[model samples]
Target: MGLRRLDIDRAALLTALTARDEGLLGTWLDLRDGTLRALVEPDDEAFEARLESESDHYVKVPLFTREFRLMAEFVEQVDDDELAVRLDQALAGPSAFRAWEGVLAADPSEQRHWRAHRESALEQWAASWLAGIGLTAPWTDEVPAPEVPALLALVMDGPVRRALGSDAEAHTTYVRACRDLCELLREPFPSRRVRSASRFARGPVVIERSGRDVTIRLRADDEAG
Candidate 1:
């Protein structure tokens, strides 16, 4: 299958993965472009149901370390010189974390350089590594349409479900929890800027744009607007 560019909210997705929040497995994303696709493996009802029932701790799959040697064999096949160097280092070591630790301990400057290098090549790495694992999900930063139902399902399963209880009264608790999650993942709209002023200000000071050349004067709460 051809590679598909999938726009994922990295922070939110990573949160679920790190927390072993298996609730997200069957969620779907309705994209801003009007296309709908499973955010994870949405159709895997059996897998998701099993996940909900299981209470085991989640472990990160060691994809890189396990495949390092095999991937190393194909270093010469890589077109990018810098990534090839990274691939070599990764292959020579037991894990990427250890390899990076050694590099940082040896030369702090090299650590910063590696960060920049990794960020620049993330798309390429995702494309290559995901393909190797038989997945076409290349990461992108584009914001997705907020499909509240699926997102709610993702964040409110397992522990949250049990905690809230299965009674009719639980719907209120579920809605409250889902609303909180949605607020956390909500994207800011209409393009605004926030500036911090005094300690007296209780929340974010948002400034929304108006007509062209429009300007607004701001003062502290003690002062007139």
Candidate 2:
């Protein structure tokens, strides 16, 4: 009878690929049959010892740091300017990875988006790595762009106007815009930045969200008019 060739356990491999911690148990490919075994640090000492002896039946799974690209690409695609800026900050300095996790954890909305992005990247990354090692991916390699939320899309495409005007649709659109705009600026808006923005205003009207507060104010230019 011919040998049974099992497909690789892709989910486990993807987890290993995305691991940033030093204690990760490595993902191993089983030669006996196409499958995987993960050995995390400080656990399963018996398997760890036997791993070297069983090299004929297993090999270290192919690896890459492709998952690290998640934060970089996610920051670029973020629709919220403030959130994008925060993500950029988290991607820098010695504690970047931890900082990024903290930031993502605080914002559940963006965290969900981040997970979707990570999943797509992980799938593509695994599929590519599997291909390099002459294994067929159980899934497609095509990573679709992370979907933009409908409210965020509306905010980005919303018309920039001085007033909501009298139209019912305009009022409806403005309410939605206000809600989404608040999400973009969840913290206090500095007065200095407000002044800077006022200098460039087409009209002296600004709609702003500070924490949970939403306010409409007249700009310096329009204040005197």
| Model 1 segments more than 4 A misplaced | 1-7, 11-47, 50-100, 125-225
> Alpha-carbon error at 48 in model 1, in Å?
1.4
Let me know the TM-score candidate 2 reaches against the reference structure. Answer: 0.51
Q: Model 1 Cα displacement at 7 (Å)?
A: 5.3
RMSD of 1: 22.0
Residue 38's lDDT within candidate 2 is 76
In candidate 2, which residue ranges exceed 4 Å CA deviation?
1-5, 20-25, 40-56, 141-225
Q: Tell me the TM-score of model 1.
A: 0.26
Task: Return the clash pairs for model 1, or none.
Answer: none
Error of model 1, residue 39, in angstroms: 13
Pick by lDDT: which candidate is best? 2
Clashing pairs in 2: 25-39, 25-40, 204-219
Q: Give one clash count per candidate, in the order shown.
A: 0, 3
